[model samples]
Target: MSGVASTRQQEVQRIVDSLSMAIAQHRLKPGMRLVEAQIVDVLSANRNHVQAALQRLALQHIVTIAPNRGAKVARPEAREAREVFIARRAIEHAILAGITIGKMALHNDEIEAHLQAEEVAAASEDRRHIIRELSQFHLLLANISDNRVLSEMFSNLMVRSSLIVALYQRNDTPDCQCQEHRAVITALRAGEVARAQAIMDEHLRHIEQQLELDDAPPPPITLRDALLVSW
Candidate 1:
């Protein structure tokens, strides 16, 4: 019984991650409805798992479920976007505490490797991959922090941040600054927790400031385009 339940849980989480990645990468645009039947077919996932996954996302505030309407990618309002950044600063502060100043940072190689990949992706100009790579940078830090609870909290925020940025961001806003990320690594390695946190604060603010929240919300895309995204 436990084995079966574990399998079911894993399947549900798989669906959730796929949807989260699609949303983060801009393939699943905000305001687009997520039809369960289509999700089941497109993901080859059972209906129950798809339903469970969507419910989990709703709990994360990454998806919205209306009374009569089905689930849709969450389109955060301007005020909500500001609140998210505020919450992000708090979470990142905790994440830094786990870094343990004066100690060698774990995942040093992985850090440099991801930074290289970020630069390459930025140069490639593949918007989907670039966005995914940039977001993964924070996820990597969460992993490095080795606090599962904090990691989960930040992961949820990170995914929601992507959605907010996609909806409210200015057309001219460039990808996250690669140089700022490098500066963060340097600060962390030097056991400069305050400096690292400061860089991260500035980095996040730069992204949020670029959002044209006064403008209209992004238009809803078709359900098919939303669900047809490949994992």
Candidate 2:
């Protein structure tokens, strides 16, 4: 029975991760409902498993479970959106400070690979791929920070940042600047930790500035259609 229970838990976690990735990749926009029936069909999972997965996401604040509206991707409030960036500034700054010149050199190839992928996605004009790759660049830096705890914290922030961008960013605003990413890399390569940190701070600030937090909320769209088109 215990083994059966553990297997069930793993299955639920798999669904949770899949949905989380869809949200983080921006394919699943903020305020979009997550219909359990559609998820069960899309993923070929049990209804119970789908419900458990959504509950887990709700705990993480990635999904919100209302009294009667069911689960929907969280649309963070303006205040919460500001807080996310503020938290990012502190956490990302720490990530840069913790990285020594030696560590940066060690991870150089991996970091460049992510940047190359971002460039390719941008040139191809694949908006979805571009968003995913751009987010990966920051995650790559967090991985190189060599602090597992901080890396995990940064990962959560990145996820929330994606939601914030989806909810607040202007339609015409680009989420990431490849040149700025390259500049940070150059600073790291030159062993200028402070420069790298400063550039990262500015980059994050620019991203925040692009958001139209005061804009009215977008109308809700069908979850099944979003999942079908995106998946």
Candidate 3:
């Protein structure tokens, strides 16, 4: 019984982490169906545990579950996407401003550690993990602001924002390593607040521009039709 429970817990954690990473890296778009059986197969876990994990993600607004529809990745509206970025810019700019004036506090060692971690994750072959690490960079920015409330708010939004980024991303970058982040960090360390803010702004704008809002999705055909055509 204990072993079963342990495995269940691990499965649930794995599902959460997988989805979270997916959202962070823009590999999973908003509104993508997460069919229960498919999730079970993907996670290599039992259906029951996958269901439980889906429910947990729903609570985080990372996924939405509906009657008869089951679970799908959460899709933020266009307005929501704009709002998320707006909030991010405001908070991050403030953090930069504070740092410029020597009002903000952050540990150099911590920032260095996160940068190293980001490098590793960015270089990782696993796209999902890279996405998670990218999303986490914003969380680290929030922490540097020394406001727990802001940190928590950014954390919640990062999950949703990641989905937005994935849904909108049109161009495939060669790697997840954000040169913009590195630039921002460099400027911040040098007490160049304006430079950091500019880099951050450019980064956000580039991400926004890469989303494919006007591109039409490919037409869907029924399996029967596909089979007929193949014949």
lDDT of each: 0.84, 0.83, 0.69
lDDT of 1 by residue, 32-140 (tens): 7899988888788999999999999999999999988999888888888899999999999889777864343557778889999999988988777678788888888
Candidate 3: tens digits of C-alpha lDDT, residues 1-231: 799898779878877777666556555556667777666655567787778888988887788999997887787667777878888788778766656424323467776777787788767756556666666777777777677766666666777777776666665442454677778878877878889899989887777776765423322332223212210
201, model 3: CA deviation in Å? Answer: 1.5
By summed lDDT, the worst window of 10 consecutive residues in model 1 runs over 100-109
Q: What TM-score against the true fold does each predicted structure earn?
A: 0.92, 0.88, 0.64
Which portions of model 2 show Cα errors greater than 4 Å?
A: 1-6, 173-176, 219-221, 228-231
Cα lDDT over the full model 3:
0.69
**Candidate 2 total steric clashes:** 0
Count of residue pairs whose backbone atoms collide, per candidate: 0, 0, 2
How would you encode candidate 2's per-residue C-alpha lDDT over 61-146 as one tens digit per residue? 88999988889888899899999999999998898877777887898788878888888888877667777888888888888888
Which rank order by TM-score, best down to worst?
Answer: 1, 2, 3
Identify the runs in model 1 with alpha carbons over 4 angstroms from their true place: 101-105, 215-231
